[model samples]
Target: MNWLGWLHDFFTDPAHRSGPDSVLNRLLEHLAFSAEALALAALIALPLGLLIGYWGRGMFLVTALTGVARALPTLGLVTLTVLLAGVGDAAVLVPLTALAVPPLLVAAAEGVRGTDPDTRDAARGIGLTHPQTLFQVCVPAALPTLLAGFRTAAVQVIATATVAAYVGQGGLGRYVIDGLATRNFATTAGGALLVVLLAVAVQLLFSLLIRYASPRGARTGLVDDPAGSPALLKESV
Candidate 1:
C-alpha cells in the first residue's frame, strides 16, 4: 500500500486502540518520559540561569556548557549510559534529560541578561528588592525568550524520546523499531507521523504561551532585548 493508505490503516487499526502496546499506552509513555526529562532540566537550568543572568555572572561557563551539551551525540550518549546504568528507563532518561537542558539553560540565561538595563534599574530604583525584581520584573520580561527556548527543548525531547524503545522502554518509537525490524513499512510511517505530530503540537502550545504570557507595557515592541542581551551576544567578558 501507499504511505497514505498505511497511515489510514494505522489510525483505524483495532490493535492500536487497546492492549499493552496500544496507541494510548505508547503516547502516555512517550509523554511521561519526555515530561520527566523536561521537568528536571527546567528545575536545574532555570534557577541557575536566573541567578547567573540576574547577576551577570558565569556567562562564559553557562554558554560553554550548554553548547557542549547540544553538540554531544545523543545516540552515543544513550548507548554509553546504558552500558553503565544497566538498562531500564535510566538509559534513555539520562540522555533525554541531557538533550533537553541545553536550550533551556542557554535561553534562560540569555533571556534574563537580555532584560533592558533601564527596566531592571527602574525596578531596583522603585525599591523592588533583589528577589522581588528577579521574580516580578526580570522573570516576566524574560519569559518570551525563555518560553521560546523551552518550546524548542520540549518538542525536541518529545521527538527524541522515541529512542527509548532502543533500551526496551515502550513508547511510540516502538512502532518504528518493530516495523523496521520486521520490514513493516506502514508501522514505521505511522510511528514517525505520530512523533512528528506530537512535536508540532508541543511547538504550538509554547507559541500560545508566549503570546499570552509575554509582558505588556515596556515589553510591547522592542522591549527587553528582542534579539538577546549584548552580554550573551559578546564572545567574551
Candidate 2:
C-alpha cells in the first residue's frame, strides 16, 4: 500500500480507535507524561530561579549546570535512569524533567533579574516588602519571558515523551516504535503526525499567553494590567 493508504488504514483501523492500546488512550498517556515532567521541572526550577534572581546570587552557577544537563543525551539519560530505577514513570520523568529544566531555569532567572531597577525602587519606596516587590513587580514584568520558557519546555517534552514507550510505558510513542519495529509505515506516519499536531497546539496556546502577558498587552489592559502597578501602590499606601 502507498503511504496515504497506510494512513487511511491506520486512522480507520478500529483497533487504533479503541481499547487500552488505542490511539486516544495513547494520546492521553503521552499528554499525561509530558504534563508530569513539565510540572516537575517547573516545581524544581521556578522557585530556585526566583530566589536566586531576586538575590542576584548563584544564578550563573545554576544556569551553567542546567546548560550541561541540556547537552546530555535524552535517550542515554533515560536508559541510565531505567537501569538504576527500573522501568516505570521515573525513568521517563527523570530524563524529560532534566530536558525541560534548562530553559525554564534560565528564563525564570533572567526574567526576574531583568526587572526594571526603577520599578523595584518605586515599589520599595511605596512601602512594599521585598516579597511583595518580587511578586507584584518582578513576577508580573517577567511574565513574557517566563511563559516563553514554559512553552519551549512544553514542546520539547511533548516531542520527546515518545521515549516512554521504549521503557514499556504507554504513550503515542508506542505507535511509532511499534510501527517502525514492524515496518508499518502507516502507523509511524500517523503517530508522528499526531505528535506534530500536539506540539503545534501547545505552541499556539503559549503564544497567546505570551502576547497577552506582555508589557504592551498589560498596558492595554489585556492581562492583569501590571502596567498600573504605581497606581495600585498608591492605592495600597
Q: Give the total clashing residue pairs for model 1.
A: 0
- For model 2, the superposed segments whose C-alpha errors exceed 4 Å read 217-237
lDDT of 2 by residue, 183-218 (tens): 988989899989999999998898677776675525
Once fitted onto the true fold, the runs of candidate 1 whose alpha carbons sit more than 4 angstroms away are 216-237
**Residue 145 deviation, candidate 1, in Å?**
1.1
**Residues 123-226 of candidate 1: C-alpha lDDT, one tens digit per residue:** 99989999999999888888878887788788889989989889889999999999899998888899999999999999788766766665443234432322
TM-score of each: 0.89, 0.89
Worst 10 residues of 1 by lDDT: 228-237
Clash-forming residue pairs, model 1: none
